[model samples]
Target: MAASSGRFESAKSIEERKEQTRIARAEVLRQAKANFEKEERWKELKRLRGEDTWMLPDVNEQIEQFSKAIAMAFSRKPT
Candidate 1:
């Protein structure tokens, strides 16, 4: 990430924008980490579908659900 250039006007508000930015960044990273496993599963499912694996349990529905869940997760504001 690029460093914030606070070269403009001096202090006005007591609230620190840097802290808010850090919190937002951390939340985004946390969400990405939580979703990483789902992404891997989706990729694996695709790969297995490409192969001749007939004994594998059906996971296409679950993958679709995961996609929806990921969308919901990203659409909400971090609490």
Candidate 2:
């Protein structure tokens, strides 16, 4: 009976170790996937920003253009 119990305990320990290893491996894989996704998002954003340069005009220029458009629209006095 004692020998059988020892064997059972050993088997249980082995199973526990295997489960722990599996959980650790799964965590590592999850972290790697997350990092890869984050990097991909950053890359996509950088690409969309257009060759490391912002294509939009300065704020003052944008405001000026908007004001001009508004003035033109008001002056047109309906088709």
Candidate 3:
């Protein structure tokens, strides 16, 4: 049993559509790979700089406070 809706597409058109989809997928993959590589390079550069920008000033102040607390703890004699 066949239902004739009178709409048809050639095999060549199907192949062309498949090829276009494949190309689009390849491009998306390439872009993702490029982004990953760029991020890796950025991290490497930051690592080489020996610090992660030291964070913001308030963050630095908190770190200093923690350090002071730790130092004070160590200085206290054990009961």
Candidate 4:
């Protein structure tokens, strides 16, 4: 019974630590995004210039497409 209780405490501590790290990572990503907008770096990029900006493609979907294209290209045998 004592050993089981000790294992439970350790498991709880590990979960708490993981939750703390997850929150910290989310905060850092939020700050980085805010800094980018504050600097207007995206505005200077010509490709994004004069765009409605409100309408944007899903980033994850775009990345998935890119990954699939790369995989298809690499899977072909060299002549």
Q: Model-by-model lDDT, in order?
A: 0.76, 0.84, 0.90, 0.79
Off by over 4 Å in 3: 1-3, 53-79
Query: Can you write out model 4's per-residue Cα lDDT over 1-79, one digit (the tens) per residue?
Result: 7776653457789899999999999999999999988668656664467363444568656887999999999999999
- How large is the C-alpha RMSD of every model relative to the true structure? 16.8, 10.9, 8.1, 12.6
Of candidates 2 and 1, the better by TM-score: 2
Give the Cα-based TM-score of candidate 1 against the true structure.
Answer: 0.36
The TM-scores, one per candidate, come to 0.36, 0.54, 0.60, 0.40
lDDT of 3 by residue, 30-62 (tens): 999999999999999987885665688688889
**Going through the candidates in order, what is the number of backbone clashes in each?**
0, 0, 0, 0
lDDT of candidate 1 over 1-79, digit per residue (tens): 2346554544544347767888999999999988998888888988877753434345766776899999999999988
lDDT of model number 1: 0.76
**TM-score: model 2 vs. ground truth:** 0.54
- How well does model 3 score by local distance difference test? 0.90
Residue 47 of model 2, lDDT score: 79
- Give the top-scoring candidate (TM-score): 3
**Candidates 2 and 3 compared by TM-score, better number:** 3
What residue runs in model 1 are displaced by over 4 Å at the alpha carbon? 1-15, 41-79
Candidate 2 clashes between residue pairs 3 or more apart in a chain or in different chains: none
